[model samples]
Target chain A: GQQVMQIPQYQHVQEGEDFTTYCNSSTTLSNIQWYKQRPGGHPVFLIQLVKSGEVKKQKRLTFQFGEAKKNSSLHITATQTTDVGTYFCASVTSGTYKYIFGTGTRLKVLA
Target chain B: SAVISQKPSRDICQRGTSLTIQCQVDSQVTMMFWYRQQPGQSLTLIATANQGSEATYESGFVIDKFPISRPNLTFSTLTVSNMSPEDSSIYLCSVYGSTPVGNEQFFGPGTRLTVL
Candidate 1:
């Protein structure tokens, strides 16, 4: 069975502080995607990383893929109250299209 | 990105009752998926809706409990049959869309089910 795990189940940061969440897959993944879900909202697509050792950035946020494609990380610089939400990493294995999501990292930024 | 919408943004049902949630996509898509998210928990995939074919369910999920209907590429339905209090959660539908970098998924607002 495939399983995805995330570290630091919950995180609390002061406004303007930096935050990072890690995701790991029990098995190698073909691709990984990041999503953000605001309180009382649906999961929104943030980014997708396909290549191993890939890094993508969105303004104050940075995303990276492990060389083995079994792990990923998302870092948000200068967090704000607007950044409050749960961050999730989803991955699908090769030869299959089903997505398995990690436990997720709940972020709370105190304004 | 595709626009996705779900019916009944929220609902309250009695235990042992069933509820059918509808998912509609603005455009045709090849892949549509159902997911459940409990309060303070991460998303758990329920099944993949195959157009004009039987849906492919994930482990811990069965066709009898969560029957799915893929009438077309743009529409699908997921019925939670004989649901219990444990079944109360946010049900979401997502679709895979083409992107310049690669395929991405877009999710609907989701239906909040509360079983009493």
Candidate 2:
């Protein structure tokens, strides 16, 4: 009975604008992962955060894991049209390998 | 990480018909997961299949509706039985790949199903 909720279910931003999505879980998680699914494409693994309060970055993207491990966030700087997609946060249930995916945030970057 | 391929990239089926989707992994994995994504929706786990063992389905999912077969470590199948319009969705297969940080899931090019 675990649930992962994400804020700003949908976002539209102009090119070069910054965007961020927040994810909150009802239960504690061992680790959290971020994935991006492009239009007409499958989900692609972007990054994973394990340690509490950890932050990782890749180019224009930044990911952070809350200190309690029950929340996470993904931020994109200077967004581009290529950044348009649905971003999802997933976490493995404690003692289980199954992943619980968040509600997902759909991003649309306008040129 | 892991390369996964799925059969029948897209299909249009009539109600009450069944469609079997195949998932093939380039390497052996301990578990393969099936997920359903409705239009503009998030991924919902359908089941987890383990080689040589019965699959473990998630809540609201039943084996009678979505039967799964894991004949080997690198291959699996999911059959959507008695399909309906509401059953139209994208079915994705995923497997975990080991990473220095943690396990990350790699998804195949999902099978898009449209039931009429």
Candidate 3:
């Protein structure tokens, strides 16, 4: 079985501060996807990283995949209150559509 | 991208009872996944349902407790049988597909279940 674990189970940051969450997997992954779930809402697709050692950016957020493809990280700079949510990293099982979600990191940004 | 809707957005049931949650997707998808999110916790996959085949339950989850029915490509149902207080959690349904950006997953609003 594959297991995905995320660091910083919970984080609270002051507005304008930066935040980062790490996702580590027990085995290498073909692709990894990131999701954000707001309070009382469902998880929404954020981005996906496929190639090893890949880096992608969206506005103030940046995503990076490890060269081994066994880990990933999401960093948000100048975070705002609106950036508060639980971040989850997911990867599909080999030869299957089933996705295993990481433990998730809950972010709380203060005003 | 797909539009996913779940029925009974929230419910409160007594112990020993059963609740059936329905998921409807606007487009046909090959695989549908059910997940459980406990309070202040992360998402845990309960099972994966595929059309024309039996659903596959994840580790620690049993078919007898969480029965799933995938009658068609765009519809599925998950029934939590003999519910208990420990079963109180948010049940989410998601579908996987390709989008303009790349392959991704779309989740439903989720059913908030509270077992008394």
Candidate 3 residue pairs in clash (backbone atoms < 3 Å): none
Q: Tell me the DockQ of each model, to 2 decimals.
A: 0.84, 0.87, 0.86
Alpha-carbon runs more than 4 Å astray in model 1? none
The digit string of per-residue lDDT tens for model 3 on B1-116 reads: 89999999999999999999999999999999999999988889999999999999988999999999999999999999999999999999999878877889899999999999
Model 3: CA > 4 A from native: none
Give a tens-digit lDDT track for model 1, residues B47-75: 99989789998889999999999989999
Model 2 stretches with alpha carbons more than 4 Å out: none
Candidate 3, residue B80: CA error in Å? 0.5
lDDT of 2 by residue, A90-111 (tens): 9887788889899999999999
State, as a TM-score between 0 and 1, how close model 2 is to the true structure: 0.98
Determine which window of 10 residues in candidate 2 chain B has minimal summed lDDT.
B96-105
Which scores better on lDDT, 1 or 3? 3
